[model samples]
Target: MKEYFNNIYLALSTIFIGMSVTFKHLFVPAVTIQYPSVKPQLPTRERNRLYVNMDDCIGCLQCARACPVNCIEIETVKKIPDEDLGLTSNGKK
Candidate 1:
């Protein structure tokens, strides 16, 4: 008889705890952001991809040296001093 009452009390306590959490959240406003229609602008400092500026690059292979994975492969050919390599977009040779 005592065991039966203890089991009943335990079940009622579990149900009360569960229902309290459910009711608490039921009245709260949703925090979800709707995608596609409400696109959030990313910060300017956010870097998602690597960007290489070829014009400014002197083929120094510094990136390869800094990489721990050795994934970057670079080859450079020394241009002849008199050869016109053409100007970059910013007009720098």
Candidate 2:
């Protein structure tokens, strides 16, 4: 009796709520974009990959240490400084 009525009421409310959502979405503009054709614009300073200048890197690992998120990596071998050093990728001496 009472339990049956409560279940019926719950079912009716659920159906109405779902229909309302469907109706709302039917009139809304789509947010989808053609991912394959649309290219995202990135800033000049944004880097999607890792790059290093082996020659300019005195093996100080400063950049790695400065990363707040600890996302930077550094690897160095102890050199006598007398070894032949190459120029950085940026042509910085």
Candidate 3:
């Protein structure tokens, strides 16, 4: 009976010790930033998505066909050879 009581006391003491350590750290300074109050700086021209110019495309469907999973869906329509189309950012027709 004494040994069982000693083991319970030791377990309770250890649990309180763990809880005390957690409570002590809760008073320490936090490194967390105030979101919305502070905006994170982003590098220039950093893109998370690819944007395609349809005017620059000659209905090649190259980008759509090139995708590994075929995630890009493209609808191709025939255009007259004499029609004018804008240039790409890389100056490609």
Q: How many residue pairs clash in each candidate?
A: 0, 0, 0
Candidate 2 Cα outliers beyond 4 Å, as residue runs: 37-93
Best prediction by TM-score? 1
lDDT of 2 by residue, 1-93 (tens): 999999999999999999999999999996887766996778989866545666667877877876768897877777678886656778866
Q: Tens digit of lDDT per residue, candidate 1, span 4-79? A: 9999999999999999999999999978879668977899897554445777678989778767677878889898
- Worst 10-residue lDDT window for candidate 1 reads 47-56
Question: Cα deviation in Å at residue 20, candidate 2?
Answer: 0.5
**Quick one: ranking by lDDT, best first?**
1, 3, 2
Tens digits of per-residue lDDT for model 3 on 1-93?
A: 999999999999999999999999999997876877976667987655555776576677778876767788988777689996667768766
Model 3: worst 10 consecutive residues (lDDT sum): 46-55
Global lDDT scores for all candidate models: 0.83, 0.79, 0.80
Q: What would the TM-score be for candidate 1 when compared with the true structure?
A: 0.39
Runs off by more than 4 Å, candidate 3:
34-93
As a whole number from 0 to 100, the lDDT of residue 55 in candidate 2 is 62
TM-score of each: 0.39, 0.34, 0.36
